[model samples]
Target: MRTPLDSPFSPGSDTVPQVWAGRTAQLSDWRDVVRPRRLAGLPERGRTILGEAGLGKSSLVRKIAADAARRGDWVTPQLRIPSGTDPLKRVAVALLDVARQAHLATSREKRIGTLLDRVEAVAAAGVSLTLREQQGPEPYSTLTELLVEIGRAAIRRGDVMVLIHIDEVQNIASEDALSQLLVALGDALTHEEDVEVPGGMLIARTLPLAVYLTGLPEFADMAGARKGATFARRFRTTTLGPLGDDDLASALQPFLVEGWEISDDREGATRVFMEPEARAAIVDLSRGEPFLFQLAGEQAWYAGTGDVITRDQVIRGWGGVRSEAAAHVERILARLPSREREFLEEMAGLEPADRTLTTIARKMGLRRGSDAGPTSQRLDSVRGIITRGKPYAFRHRAVEAYLTTYWPDPPAGDAERESTSAEGIG
Candidate 1:
């Protein structure tokens, strides 16, 4: 059976291989950031990898782990959590899962039984074991105990370094929970503390273990800022941006035949893959985003029956592109409160320079004046709406399109007038 990694269209697609070609610069940056410094007998600080959704953050982390494992320097474990659970519990489960998978315990049953034993031990010590319930004051101490145990196990096996990777760090609702978790792990790795009894492990001789956090840019900011001095200062931050034109072409090369590839037909292929104007349109729309570019290409590719993609295919594929963009915008918007959503609707209607607070507030039925100062602050308060200093721009062009199509117009009570007003504003 062909793996999903083999094709872009398949479910469970593992895009890590293509990620190198598509996001070469990003991959290289991540490699430099994650390279262990322990060859010289110095412990490398843990890293926080940041990128927007679908911008290959997870792929970069996976690549780093694969590379590290291949070099035999570390044990890499990937942990994923389902939605709507305390992240600390998710982290605990992931750690236990990693231990079990490594087969350090004598038997499969023994591994889980050992984990349960530790959980009970910690709980009996007044740490909360209730995964779904609120964490008690001792949750941080409990996590600290767990990390110390894992570090001891790693040392026993002669593995001096262990990397625990947590994906989708933004999904966790409690900033304090994340903060507590990081603080506990950071203390375990850096602080000279000893765990006593069944939970206590030898401190100085234990190997170093690092926790890697991965998520969108906003989540990283939230985690870093909310975690304050302790967790924030302990880890390094790495941001992943969009692929450059050359790297973008490289990313697509594997799916294309040698001479007939899109790079060879750059201009014509772009026009075909997007509208005649869509070459620029899609680029502006995607902001050089990897997934959006691939989405646009996929739409055009599927629309074309022959070997070459054409402008007609791109035009036909616009529906698919727009649909994907709308869905993405809805997801982002769903997280916002009603007032913010109203702010977004108003902000979406503004032209590049016209998205100042005065204009947005006026449109949202807030204020009638041309003053840009207070209104700007008010608009800025709306998350994901406008970046500071820059003209109000949707994070993605697909979002702009969605806002244009779906968000109801200001209460003019006239569809024709609203259409005219929207086009005029644009």
Candidate 2:
């Protein structure tokens, strides 16, 4: 069968993977990490997966849910809230949705009747029966209560697992609320308190319930710092690194079946995708970053002749990719505070700052009298600018290339006009 690469209608090679792979393959690896057996040993706690942006954490979570459903297991309800939403409300809405799905999935009329009856009971007991409007604060407490109710209902239905998957969990308002929710979930699962789901009476129970959270790397540190909070300890933390060579190859397999091929002429393309050099050059340049790999590969594909991607094509495609990356950096820079922006601009002026936070800070004029320590501290505080450890590399290579290469002297207006006119020929 022809795959996406075989079709002329496919998006330009530079398009994001989500546009083609859908969500399945994007998250296939996560199934092993979150398998039910792996989670069985832990007390009723939470599971947290952390990674940088574009690392596919959300894709993994969705895949886990899909896999569970395929196995006839009751997948937990997933709720993705924007960063900084109230945790309680997010939890409440997620539970309500899960309850509704469970009610619908029941095959026996009596079981369906019982599910609906419970849902109605919870709604009557002050849980908002309707889904919240998009703009309002979510009713979190209500949702937590609902989860307890659903867990009980699942127990009665013969050990069905009720999962709660929350994405971008770091954005949840205040760590306290997150802590409370975790504590509550633990208690509900272990002590059988909170929603009062009648512990021993409901057949053999394995606490067939779980919570999964995804977020940036800093989330763990932030949660760790919270005093008297054990949420960090309760969770089995999984840090997702870049896709291994085998996995990366597997991800690209679907494309190879078609006429599209990675040849030896592309810059990053051949180095990473096709060449036998120690680890692909593209991977090195990308630091094995998933989104960057896709960006680089897509550019190489679009620039190649006759659909076969060559190293030269990848090199040529770098310009386009860099342009796109620059746009992203511009947006990020636009949001920075003036002082931070100036600091970043100063660092960007250095030829090669070695990607060390200390070196970049020194270049940015961040020094205290004669001491370098204060400058380092200042840089660390500006999260938007310095990004803690590594000298803030632009999130996109294209952006770095633009700032370092194109920013000095932008294309001439006349040149741009002529280029535009030439493009009109197409």
Candidate 3:
């Protein structure tokens, strides 16, 4: 009897997998750039990660928050962007969740302590109005005061940093709301005030506080492209793309070494192997979108027998999981802006073998293929919809499959061009 252990792969959106493959660049930015700057008491800008759905944006944020929280010197409060409610109140609650994480309650700094207590009281009570009444009329203005005061208090105790993270930023109330938020963060970031230490010595220091945002690529135009210098000076947007071939291989390697447990006896480890063909199938199917890696891996694990996950097993897994995979592709495309979606649809209508940059440009109704080059590359790099291959194609095979299945029929003369071998996606 095959002892079936539950699937080890984490397949849900924003679910950090056991292996946690790829994202070297994002980690580097946090480590080399943000971490050092905050440690040195140097001012740092907010990091905004933008990508399509299933690109691991939220997972990356949560990973970083977990890292920061473990540092013992940083207070990391993470929140998902709110809709139909007071967004600032949601933020207030996130802050209150970690209020005890900072050393703000000390008796030495009465003013800072009192400030912390006031914020703690209002935020803990969940009285949105009470929190707002003490500060400026604008919620952002009130937020600025809260961040600056709390960050100052934290830094005064010891060199500490405050990292505020908000995910699903595209859902933030409105453009005006985001603009105000940027202004508020900019104000708090630049706030350098007199700090009284235990010995009554005062020092002027900038609050070691930074914000991190993640959402769809459109969010760049929302918060990253504000009308003023605040966005440019104090914030940066990093567009996340798919994992490479190596990341696919690396994610599956652990199963081999650890021996996927397959028997009722938990102590005895089954000798599990992932063939090169199995890895290739994963690379081809996932094409680097983070969630697909997990999903495909999960399916492959379930379909395999004995010890090894062979290419045939992987293909069978894909066949079994194709409908769900296509659903994921559909949802991602459904969430994209119309122009972005249309570009993908135009490409999907082409014969997969003919999906060159020039062909895509012409298909997009552009006069010259060169006109589409930058946009195509940007779509690949910024949004990860297209591949960086010579003949540019949908990055994920399921993208082509989704579009091919639902795209409108071609004109009479173009029927030959209409049919795509999207069958391989399964």
Tens-digit lDDT track of model 1 for 1-426: 111122243112334543243555545544553343322223456677776466666776787677667755454466654455566666666665555544545545554455556654443432234344454435666666656666665555553456778877777666556666677667765644342435556433323565677875566557656676766567777665555555655544444433222322233432112233334333434445566666655555575545544444444454555656556557756756566677768787777788766677788776563444443443343232455465566544444656764321212233454346547656
Q: By descending TM-score, how would the candidates be arranged?
A: 3, 1, 2
Best by lDDT: 3
Considering only N, C-alpha and C atoms within 3 Å, which residue pairs clash in candidate 1? 195-200, 196-200, 275-278
Segments of candidate 1 deviating more than 4 angstroms:
1-6, 9-26, 38-45, 49-53, 73-77, 100-127, 130-161, 174-179, 192-208, 216-226, 236-247, 253-287, 304-321, 357-385, 390-395, 401-426
lDDT of each: 0.54, 0.51, 0.68
The runs of at least 3 residues in candidate 3 whose Cα sits more than 4 Å from the true structure, single-residue gaps closed, are: 1-6, 103-137, 157-159, 193-205, 225-228, 257-271, 337-339, 348-426
Tens-digit lDDT track for model 3 on 76-170?
A: 55677766444555666666544555544443767656555555554543334444466525556556767766676576666566888887877
**Candidate 3, after superposition: displacement of residue 23 in Å?**
0.6
- Candidate 3 residue pairs in clash (backbone atoms < 3 Å): none
Best-to-worst lDDT order: 3, 1, 2
- Give lDDT for model 1: 0.54
For model 3, the local distance difference test gives: 0.68
